[model samples]
Target: MKWEKLGLVCTADRFGVDVPTRVMVPTPVFVNEDTIRVFVTVCDKDNIGRPYYVDVDARDPRKVLRLSERPVMDVGTAPSFDEHGVVVAQVLKTRDGKLQMYYSGFERFRDVRYKIFTGLATSSNNGESFQRVKTTPILGGSDYESTFRCAPFVIEFEDRFSMWYVAGSSWETIRGKQVPRYSLKYLESPDGIEWPVEGRSCMELQHDEHGFGRPWIEIDEHGTYHLYYSIRVCSLAAYRLGYATSEDGLNWVRKDAEMGLEPTPGSFDSNGLSYSAIIEAHGSTYCFYNGNDFGREGFAVSKLIK
Candidate 1:
């Protein structure tokens, strides 16, 4: 199957909105038959992050993305976890009539010292609001003393929840140094909170010219699993998308699509594309990825015509 550009759906400068100062990562999901829900992380100059939900009609071309009056979730003092900040959430409907949102959080005080963790929240109503689960830090720091854990992606398979998240050491140093290694790992949960996994790095960076991180997964119509991740060597600007496939969730094999998607000749995405989120709806597959060195978010659609 071939993918085609669907033009820019959401940009920083659209609808009289200010250009997002930090970064905009979108998680697009099909809420129902005629509506699509997009949860975006808006990072401002102050470095404070907020979650916004936008609902758009599936059939409208000149559609306006409507933001929810109130944020679905935010960083607050909960005593147990996530007092710093919350961002980049992946929402899914569980079997028991509840919405599960697996998100990444950072302790503001600890984040100043470079520490991060993952948290979970749930909503009975379809994303109108959410409540923090009693269990916190489903996945925490590793034995390596990794500094941060963020960017979680969740999927349900065989009555269980599977998650892939980014984990790495501190980019800053104790005195004056730089650490440049990041990786993606996998964990499993039955209740979307308690992940009991050992010290196992599901996917790590090989000592090669290209580095790998930011992994996202989607199961195709024929039950084939596709994984899209970021490959960066030096700077974040020199990043590209990579692809892999798996029959089962655990074992994966790399594919030939080394540069999964790149820039067009005369387009805004002429720089690069990464942070990919994919959803298959109505017999068509859509990939929503950020563009232009994380300047804006764009989308591309392709049909599984094979």
Candidate 2:
């Protein structure tokens, strides 16, 4: 779809980070009638990953009022896995009034390439404090899988919970060497615990000479589902976001410029922007996406002019 640029509402500046160096992926949420909360992955000067929460009053959306006193979550426990780092993703408020977080965990070890997994955490006090689910590592290695799972986006559909995550072969071939080039896959859970990947696991979008992966999807109130994903334009040595739509949440159709909301130039996002988290508010749509080579998170607003 072709999206008309409507200026940036928030930039990396809000976190005191310099472009091309620091990176931040923000997941926004409407906490209440008066508050908006953004959960971000904050890296220290030493590049250690930590979780930070920034809150703003819905009344004055421009002013950030509170930041967490300490990293709400971080790497803990060792040898088992996920001992190296952890990063936060979109937080969801369950039907039972509990807050659930879907996050990625990274572990390091010799003889093993790397391990990435999805974990679940819950909060009872409206997100102030959280406890990891007892049945942890909710999503991990398949019997024949390797490498890891990362960048999970989850949402409730109808009465079921669904997630789209980046998955790839544990092996890769690069310049006379082999490595893993991760791609995206889809899974669903009835209760957000035991997830089973769909038969059609990967996106079938035509590639742009490089490859494609990292999908973020959203279903609007009207039941229309939209997916925004990243694809590398090898000739340009850059990544770009592409759009597709599905009414049944399975088969999808790529929309062209003639359809509306095509890519635009200018702004911090002109270079590379993908992994878009989209939400609709006050009758308009806002997309929060990583910008400029996935080094920082920025937002762009569009009126869904289609």
For each predicted model, how many residue pairs clash, with residues at least 3 apart or on different chains?
Answer: 0, 9
lDDT of 2 by residue, 106-139 (tens): 7766765567777888888777767788434777
Show the colliding residue pairs in model 1.
none
lDDT of 2: 0.62
Cα lDDT of model 1 by residue, 152-212, tens digit: 7888777777887777764633225343356767777786777764334766665442345
Model 2 residue 293 distance off true place after TM-score fit, in angstroms: 3.4
Residue 77 CA displacement from its true place in model 2, Å:
2.3
Runs in model 2 lying further than 4 Å from the true structure: 1-21, 57-63, 110-113, 134-136, 157-159, 171-180, 197-199, 208-214, 256-267, 296-306
Give lDDT for model 1. 0.63
Q: Kindly provide the TM-score of model 1 when superposed on the true structure, using C-alpha atoms.
A: 0.81
